[model samples]
Each structure stands twice: as structure tokens, then as C-alpha cells.
Target: MSTPHTRRSFIGHAAAGFSTLALPRWGQAQPATEPAPRPAQIEHAVTAPVAIEVNARPIPAFEPRDRSRTRFGSLQYRSGLVLTSPHRGFGGLSGIRVDAKGERFLALSDQGSWFTGSIRYSGRAMVGLDDVEAAPMLNAEGRPITEKRLWYDTESLARDGNLVYVGLERVNQIMRFDFSKGGTRARGEVLPTPPAVRKLPYNKGLEALVFVPKGQPLAGTLIAFSERGLDANENLIAFLIGGPSPGQFSVRRTEKFDISDAVLLASGELLILERKFSWFTGIDIRIRSIPLKSIAPGALVDGPVLFNADLGHEVDNMEGIDAHVTAEGETVLTMISDDNFSLLQRTLLLQFTLVE
Candidate 1:
């Protein structure tokens, strides 16, 4: 009885190999530091990524006693829309909108003590939460903010709607939450990481936020953080405008080109999503695309596997990606996964159509 489009084609065909992740004993105590600074001009061009065609369908999701564990790491996209959260949950569904108002909104973020509710999208569409509240205790800049600091992953929502950039990751800082400042606790202000990534070591937070479009000469909004570790030597850093305030971020290095589910690909390019599990072989995931001027920081290119799900195709933990247009004009890519509530792990939504 599978049918979420056949469990996303069984997660793109049962899954296979691409292993190389080993660096998380608890974090901290591994920072020789020295790799950051690449991209003088970078004009390399060599497209590959062209093998994603899973429509077998059937993804209801459930398979997480411990398939590795990772509910939500980072993701945010606006207008065309996308948002998520679940690595640990006090508040489950964080944000996800694919508007014109066709309807797709599942928002919440109170993980400080877990009291989220009011997530709607069921009837069979999937995405279900309830209506919880009572977990917010914000005060910052005035004190009284006891723990439950929110630990937020990363978020962005400010083309000009009135700011919404969150990245507390336990408190390295990157606030900005002022939904017009009416009241929701409002307290967003920090913004400035880059003393060589705040000095590295354990401060390891910040996952994803892409805004790009402030003024030129070098505008702003292109954060992308996730040093989780596994390859490319580590240090997946990139920050240009940054905003909020602290020292004003500007670090760099992204040309190493590895695979870890990066985003921001409206033809501007730079899409990386990967996951491959193994018990013997029972999970698969892939999505790749690069062209952000070929990438700069550290400049070390080599990504072109594109799609290879045991060769058949199947997708499960393929977390976040956005770039919609469709109606004939063409150009659609919507993917989401982060069901760490663990029944087995399933909360996926994938749709692709971009080839040029």
C-alpha cells in the first residue's frame, strides 16, 4: 500500500553508495584552520547533473528508529517559497509556502521548550501538526531571556517584507526577527560572524539563508553555513552582506564542490542535495547543479554525479530546495524532507523540471 508517489519512487530506487561522512563525536577539538579564501574571478563552466526522474510515487514516510538521525538542518526560500525544521523538535513544522495562495503553509518554531501546534495539510496531502503555543519567553536586550534560547537553525524572509532572518543555532547570534515589530516577541538583532568563522572549533552553527539583492557594489543576503563535516576538507562558509550587525560578515570559500544539500538555484545555480544509506542497501537520494559563476571560496571543483539512485531511483531524506515557475514557462524544483519524528522517516515532497 505505498503511494506518496510510490514512496518517492522508493526513494529513487532502494538507494546505494556515496559514503564519506565521519566527524561528529560531539563536535569541537579539530580546527587547524587555514582553508578559506578562493574565487578571484572563477569562470569555469561544465554542467552535468541530469538524472532525476522518479515519479513512481508512494511516499507516505515512516522509517526512523535511527536511520542516522537528522530532522532539520537548514533551508529557506521565498516568493517561489520553501522552509523547514526538525533535527530535534519542541515545535515541529517550521515554514513552507508555495504560494499564489494555492495553499501550503506549515509554520512553527518554539523548540525552546516544545509547544508547537497548528500545522495543517492533511486530508491526505500530508504534513500534520496541531496547535500548541506556550514555549516562547523572549526578552533579549532587556534580559529575562532564560534558556530555551530557541536554538533556531536558519531562516530568511526579507526581500523587504520587514525582516525574519533567524539563526540562533544555540546562540552564536544572527537574529533579525521583526515581523513589522507588532509583537511575536520580536528580538532579532545580532548578525556578524567571520573572525575566521567566529574562530571555529565548536561554535559550529548556522545552516542556510539566501537573500541576495540589497544594493550592488555587493548588496547582501547569501549566507549558507554548515560545517557539519565529511569532506571538501570542511568549512562550507560563505557570507557577503549578512546585515543585522556585528562586524558585518564577508568570509568566502565554496568552490571545493562537495555534496550536502545546498540551495539557491534559480538558474543562477548552486544546488547540492545528497543522502545514501545502507543496511545492505535500502535508501538513496541525489540532486546536483552548479553554476554560481562556478563558485569561488577555496575554488576546488569536481561535482557531476547528478543522479544515481542504485540506478533506479528512490528518495527519502532529501531535505529542502526551491525554485518554482511552472505554467508552461517551465522551471520547477521543489523538494522537502525532514521527518525525524521517526516512525522510519518520511515527509518528502519532490518535483523537478529544469534542464538547460
Candidate 2:
């Protein structure tokens, strides 16, 4: 993870092979979303029409021709690449979701912003991105909620139809926004989080969440996972809320990584994204998928680590993960990194196919 910094600097210069789209021509036909709201207690003055300008560049390689057999547990490389923008507020991305078609995507920045765009691919490898828009998450008053107490660290997101839930880490609260309402008026209202959520360490609270679809084992349930919160038995704590299995659950933590994000597979399994870092080891990331049949009240769920990678593999602070199926009926997992707005780190978007 990039070290947290306080200074603000916007790198507006796009390097070679980069592309940008400002208003009018941008967001022409995409989903309607409000502009970044009036920033609350922001550091810089809001002087531009766009709150966050995106600079996208192409990254054309995944694996070499002779190295097609590469595997990490049950995951095989489909394609992966890096994304970098000089928007000082662009880092700390923690939540992501791709549309049913796997074409459009929505993600949340830990610093309190929303990123939406189309994923560009060349044949099978991700080549670049287009139609990108980054805006601040708005409060009920039509203002950026960053002004609220310890509220900027938006960490987890889940979508159920038009309802979107965002988990703010430091704030230990869930904000609900109804996208069913059109663009300019979809300001958010806070949801009633379980009392257990507020008791977790502020920084490690609510790192991942996913809504159980109507046909799933825990149908209509919302499973919220913490970054590092523990149970009475020292196991990682998760909450089962708003469905048949409403209570507390646990997932065994191994290899010293905390949960970063998670996704619900079509078969009702939970795929977890985790990361670990140390001065000597730099950064390491992994994924573990457990069956929903095994998740219940007080259940200790553990699954084989499906994938693991490090900085050597072009991975940065790989924090966001979501799964989608391609037209060919293959499970493609997409992951993105939170650069923490630090110059030393590069925001990355990666894709892989699960072989098991």
C-alpha cells in the first residue's frame, strides 16, 4: 500500500500513448451519474468543470507466447496491466464492480470518489480504457461527504439492482445510494450498520461486501467482511445481515494477509482478495474462494488459496476484485490496485481466469 500522504498535487500532463476525455464529448451515452459534489472542507478550491480528470495509457502485454502454462493455484493469467494518473486524489481505490456484460465498471476510491468506465481489450489482452469518469461520492445534501468526520476512506461497495452500498472504513458506516433515481438527485443516506461494525478498529472495518442474489444459499443477505477485525477465537470476523443467515461468521486468516475485497461467484462461492506488506517483502497479494454452503453462523470457513502474486508480477497494492463471465462462458476475475495517491505506486487493473 502506498504510504498515506496529505499534500495535494495534480499531474495533468498525460505521458505518451495516453488519452483523455473532458466533458461534453465525455459521458455522452454512459449511465447517468451526478458530477462530483461540492467538496466538503477540501484542500484545493473547486475551479474546474471536472472534479477528477483521467489520463489513460495502454499496457499491451500479459504473458509471453512461450509462457502460456503459468498458474497460481487455481487461477491462470488471462491478462493484466497497469494504470497511472497524476490526479493526487486518484489513489486509495478499494471497491469495484463490473456490469453484467463485463463491459462497463464502477469503482470507489478510498479518498471518497467514484470511477466508472469501459474496459478496453485487444483480442484477449486488456489494451486500454475509454469513457472514463471520476467523480466524488455525494452526500444527501448534494455535497461531497468528505467533510464528515473521518469519512473519506470509502472502502467497500456492493450493488443490488439500483441500490449501491458503500462502506466507509474510518467512518465505520454504510452509505446507500439509489441509482434508480436519475443523475443529479441520487444523493446518499446512511444505512444502519450492525453495532459490531462500529466496535472494530476504525481502519480495519468493513473491507468487503456482496449481496446474495435471490437464488443463492444466503439469498437477499449482505455479507460484510472486515479488513482485520477478529472474533472471540482470533478468527477473522464477518457479518451476515438482512437475510436468513443474519449473525456473525468467521474466516480463518492465513499467511498474514487482511481482506481487501470479495465477490460472489455464480455458483454461490465467496472469492476473497487479500494483501500483505512488510519492509523486507514489499507487497504480496492473494485470493481464496470458499463455498457458500460452508458459511453460516459462527462457521469457521477456510478455502485453498486460489492465487497469489507479488510486486515481481506487476502488482501494486492490489485491493479491489470482482468476477464476471465472458460471452464464451468463462469466469474472468478483475482486480484493481489502490495506489494510495503515492507517486511510488502505480494503479493497476488485472484479469485472470479461474481453472478449478
On lDDT, the leading prediction is: 2
Candidate 1 weakest lDDT stretch, 10 residues? 42-51
Give the C-alpha miss distance for residue 156 in model 1, angstroms: 6.9
* Cα lDDT, model 2, residue 103: 76
List the RMSD of every prediction in angstroms: 21.7, 8.2
- Model 2, span 222-285: residue lDDT tens: 8999999988777799989788968888999887889999999998789999988665566678
- lDDT (10s digit) by residue, model 1, range 282-347: 455555555555444444433454443321322454544545464566555555554433343344
lDDT of 1 at 312: 30
In model 2, which regions exceed 4 Å deviation? Answer: 1-69, 86-88, 183-185
**Runs in model 1 with CA error above 4 Å?**
1-187, 190-269, 274-285, 294-305, 308-315, 320-337, 340-356
Candidate 1 lDDT for residue 333: 52
Count of clashing pairs, candidate 1 = 35
Estimate TM-scores for all models: 0.25, 0.83
Locate the minimum summed-lDDT window of 10 residues in model 2.
5-14
